[model samples]
Target chain A: MDSIIFLRPTRGLAALNLRDLWVYRELVYFLMWRDLKVRYKQTLLGASWAILQPVVQMVIFTLLFGGVANLSSEGVPYPVFNFTALLPWGLFSKALSDAGRALVNNRNMITKVYFPRLVIPVSSVLAGLVDFAIAFGVLVLIIIYYHFAPGANFDFHFTPALLTLPLFLILALVSALGFSLWLSAMNVIYRDVGHVLPFLTQIWFFITPIVYSSSEISSKWQWLYALNPMTGVIEGFRWAILGTQSTPALLLIISTLVAVVVLISGLFYFRRMERSFADEI
Target chain B: MDDIAIRVENISKSYRIGTAPERYRTLRDSITNAGRHILAARHLAARLSAGRSDLARSPDPSSHSTIWALKDVSFDVRRGQVLGIVGRNGAGKSTLLKILSRVTEPSTGQAEIHGRVGSLLEVGTGFHPELTGRENIYLNGAILGMKRVEIERKFDEIVEFSEVGQFIDTPVKRYSSGMYLRLAFAVAAHLEPEILVVDEVLAVGDAEFQRKCLGKMSDVAQAGRTVLFVSHNMSAILRLTEETLVLEKGRLAYRAATPEAVDYYMAAGFSDAGERLWQASEVPADAAPFQPLALRVRDPKGRVVDTARSTEPLSIEVEYRLDQPITGLRVGIYLLTMRGEYVFTSFDTDDPGKFEQHSTRPAGHYVSRCTLPANWLNEGRYVLAVNASAFHVKRYFWDDHALAFNVDATGAPGKHWPEPRLGPVRPALDWMIETL
Candidate 1:
């Protein structure tokens, strides 16, 4: 008997087609490659801009917050302290914004052709990893420079905690993908999402711990801070790289739970709205 | 094994029309609309609720804003059958293709396919200008649902067919539009799917390229694959498919062999051989002051005809109604070849005397006629587009390509040539051949 495929309008909450996604994995890879390639095209600085962005932000933060405000960095040098957190934060924010606009940016494909719609946002998020890797190299240079700087009290210690770095990075990715899934789907229907995204990301940045450590927050408010998924991710990066704080098991657990919930709900919301994308877009 | 390749069962798609283009309804709009409906129907709430099912089937009688793009459309294609769909603009042709391609879902029913479907709904779809020709080939191939290995296998053939090997590594931004479309078409054509669905993407490219595409399509059809094609070019449709479907106002009007189906589609809405009378409902509300009543084509004997002999004078009459006196109103007819090349535009007031006589027309029904002298038109199908407007003030009403008729060259001056002449008009002129 011939294999048959039946298509019907999805009603209620629809499940993700993991098998179809698996079949189209190559397409996802190519889309990510296209995004990465197009991002740097025709620019003189090219990929160097990726590394330069976080470095520039770190310099400004050190001058404004570290020096002016005398913010505590858990006894570590402010530049090194802020750079570690910035790496994960930078990845999170960039991935989130890029993935959020992915669907609208590929409007031609969305309207003219058909593929697993999830591939678009997923590939945009994945493409930001290349920039993250570049920026991470700059962070490593800063660490090595401070370790040997004269009169510097900083110590370079490699810990087993560094093994958990991948865990924190994956956590950041999941949260970014989660928010992007919702934003991208919403953006197709309501362009207001596009107009409001930049402000939302900026507000989210202030709430997350990048320049200042979470220790600065009052102990009473730590639980509420953990509700922001990036808090655990940024703090975990600091803990893993600088070995400053002990494992915040509670923060990690709570943030991980929130990230998982957001990711799952975002997936379902995206699938529910996927059917109308071609028409609305 | 199942012999059927595609089965569409009672599929229908409806859309809310005449609404703001902003498809995403904001919360405030939805709330206000709901509140307004509730307030207006408070006393009839119970009765309305009871008739909800019937109401859903047909939109509110007072609000004529909903349009069913496709209604209860059902058809089946056996393996290796080539089916063609023909319709006027907004006749639900594109909607049907979108549903079958799974780009959008139908409001009711479903479609089943026994094989993988590849659709080329638009040419050069998803081709980034910054990308090189080679990169874009893979990108477009992937967009058309081709796998990486499959693209790699056919990469050489695609390049050779496109004839852009010299610039394959250069960015498509630097290539001319023709070159870009060639590469795009080549990649799409090489997508060897079991079921191929194509829209009017072949309308691009030069005449030579169009011929090449037509040949390629015929080859695909002859290879025993199921193909569904939609095109405005009836010649291509007649050449490629054996069976055709005609859609009229979101419903299936006729389904038969290609030639017969094309005849039915071309003759749709016409009451007589060469005359069309517009119903009041068919006219949009915006064209209120100048309402088109009827359009007819007649021979010199004043007899309405669908086919005109090129040896005789032919006349076209546009009958319209004016509800109020209008100044500077000119009724004109645009003659064009079936392929959409404009031959000329003639207005009733082109003559200074006529313009002075009827500068302002009073409220009444009137007929504006234009006559084409004998042996002036070529033997081919022609389209008549009617326009009523005041020079630069405003366009009261305009219907582009409103009517179609045929001109036969059986007794035309070109009968001695025994070859087809190109262009829309074939004017017979005085010739004096010298003995030089």
Candidate 2:
């Protein structure tokens, strides 16, 4: 028997069994592809829903937060700034909801056949990325529109830090997947987990600096705010694409650590609870 | 030993079932229980060390806690084998399959399946009613671990087998039940996984479709692949598989050849034997006039019995409490084979002279016997579920679980069992081995 390894501050966190996941990667890809096709199959807009989600949200944030609330867009245009952050954030939100209920939603599959239970949530997270890419295309178009097509002072240019955008996106993916694993496993046993997910997401949005700039927050509470994990991801995106000076470096470091902690613990909790899912669901 | 495609070590799964409280517990109860398991563990240990039994007790007290499913189970299946799992409902057959598929992990032990697995636990699994048949086919195939290329290669065959044709592009919600079952089974069967796990979803299809599926499963098994099939249909189990495992109430009750295992499963009656004969809460007051007061199946001596050879004289004795004497009454015993096949019906009207006027005061019991001559039934597990009607079938009483019995084979096995082979009648036959 292998030695017990705990992945959390609290004891009894089960092993993640990473080797099994590696073996089932092909299955994981197929499941993700299946989810992507089915999600868009009969929808009226097809893939357009992806571009529309963040684009609509960007318009709302630019009007409400930038206009009435006077939230700073740093030196960048509010539309471009909000769209970039919302692109990844929207993907994270979709992943959270989809992965959170993947097990319960597929009750027939869960009770009848056997496959790695982890595959369900992981595939949900992966499938949401396709939507993120579609939304990202819209963000680029909006950036060009504001910078060059109109009478605007903004100059669109790529920087070396643009490469880190993928890393930040990866961080957000892990963060959503981590929380989703816990939610999906819990949703199988207690349906209330699903009922509370929307409220949870609403509160989580406030904690992440998705709407207002993180620069407005005082430094004393930066470490605490960074505990939200998504803080680092959103701030990093605004910094990379919008070229914001106040990137909240200290908050990004602390939130990265926090995200890692939540992810590892979430995965362990999920894997431990996974064994009973089929029976109970 | 041949390649062990699947190895199941001793595994047990238990569910902690808690009744819904009359009212949700207050925050105080939550804090108390959480504190006991976490915050008080060290203090409770100290209290135990100090010899204070009451203070040292653990908390999170659960009322009437019981395990709802599964006990130690172990088995192995070689490559290129089709193993049938047969049991009544709630017998843990599905639970075992879920464990093997790793959709759920075993509670106590481990199961190692060596190859890719594709499972069809029920018809239309992983299908969204809003999704077209074509979309569902891909979703189900992916869920079964099949790549797009693999599904593409078998796509035409699947469509042909299901006979969905133009309807394949339509959402499955509009499809008939037969079409839904066909498409679901076709995707699962054609997925080309090394190991195929199927439940009794095919039984939902039409007779011709069910036959086609059974034939396909036979072909798959013959191609040196592994299969784990779970079904309540004994004939399907016996026809498609060589090895069988029987589970009863989450435990491995028996395992052997297909026929013997199915026989054991059938012999174990479906109803819970421990339940009381009469439940006041279960009986409906609306069934007052035609209530089933008593039920019994017996031999000539009137002793209750449930097993007999095909040639033995047998009878079903149904005793009913009639509120009033009624004429033109029809008392019939429906003979159903274990596979739910209706063999034949025997009614009192078959013998016109058997009816006689007999009255009793107020409410009283009456016995109606259904007698069958020797060698009438085929050799199989038969149930004597009975029903009665009055006033030319105006209305009556029906008891689904009246009684069930098994009819053993009295015939010989045509030199297979080293005994004299009897004819289909199971009665004395004259020999004809003369000058010819």
Q: Tell me, by DockQ, which candidate is best.
A: 1
lDDT of 2 by residue, A174-275 (tens): 888888887887777667777789999899888778878777789788788888878889999877887787556897798788778878888888877766
**Number of colliding residue pairs in each model:** 0, 3
Q: After superposition on all CA atoms, what RMSD does each candidate show versus the true structure? A: 5.9, 8.1
lDDT of 1 at B277: 78
| Whole-model lDDT per candidate | 0.86, 0.73
Q: Give the backbone clash total of model 2.
A: 3
Error of 1 at B267 (Å): 1.6
Candidate 1 lDDT, tens digit per residue, A66-153? 9999899998999999999888888888877888888988998888777889989888888888888988889899999999998889
Kindly report the TM-score of the first chain in candidate 2: 0.92
Chain B TM-scores per candidate, in order, are 0.72, 0.68
